[model samples]
Target: MELNNKKVKELLPQKEPFRFVDYVDDVDKNNKTIQCNYTFKSDNPIFLGHFPQEPIVPGVLLIEAMAQSAILLMLCIGNEISLDGEKYLLSKVEEVRFNKPLFPNQKANIISKIERSIPHFYFFSSKVYNGFEDKILEGKFIVFKK
Candidate 1:
């Protein structure tokens, strides 16, 4: 199912200025993968201190974006695991590589595939791409649902 901004907001716990995911373009429950996107606004406060001269989206935010995408995919897997009354938290981030910097007003395409899942934790292999298809970042994220 495709999750638009409003639907995404309903599923995610984050609010504006903190929510990085703008929309989820695709979702594959069978494959446990999702494709999502986020557009950076020029007036984002992070730009103020991140370097007013050459502001860039922080790598941390990129990681959060990927996590959000992964969480969305997990929720779509089935109603059994949907977010009824639970919280998803970031547990670990491994082998994270930042290839390029994301600037204001630029959109990022995020693809997240679940590599594996434990009893309460899910590991995901994720990548962020620019409009040109160039990879901006790649990493493995572990999230704990509790």
Candidate 2:
């Protein structure tokens, strides 16, 4: 299913300034993969201090974006998970690498796949790519559902 910005807001637990996902392009439940997009607004306050001269999107926020996408994947698939009264927390991040820096106003495509899953923990491999299709970051992370 394609989740637009409105649906993304409804499904995502984060609020403005914190929510990274703007929309979901696709959700392949059978393959356990999801594709989403987020644009780093030039007016974001972080750019002001991250670097006064040459502001760039922090690497940590990129990871958060992937984590958010992972959560969306879990909720969209047939895992029977719901946010009605549940919370999903990022429990771990591993083998993360930043290949390129993203600047303000740049749109990134976040792609994530379920690597494996245990009772209440889900492992995922995620990647973020720039508009040019260049990979900017890649990593593996785990999410704990409560």
Candidate 2 residue 138 Cα shift, in angstroms, is 0.2
Top-TM-score structure, candidate number: 2
Q: What is candidate 2's lDDT per residue for 17-120, written digit by digit as tens?
A: 89999999999999999999999988899999988799999999999999999989989985664687888999999999999999888899999999899999
Alpha-carbon local distance difference test for all models: 0.90, 0.93
Off by over 4 Å in 2: 79-81
Clashing pairs in 1: none
Q: Which predicted model would earn the best lDDT?
A: 2
Q: Give the TM-score of candidate 1.
A: 0.96
lDDT of 1 by residue, 67-140 (tens): 98888888888565358888899999999999999888889999999989989999999999988898999999
* Global Cα lDDT for candidate 1: 0.90
Q: If candidate 1 were superposed on the true structure by all CA atoms, what would the RMSD be?
A: 1.2
* lDDT (C-alpha) at residue 136 in model 1: 97
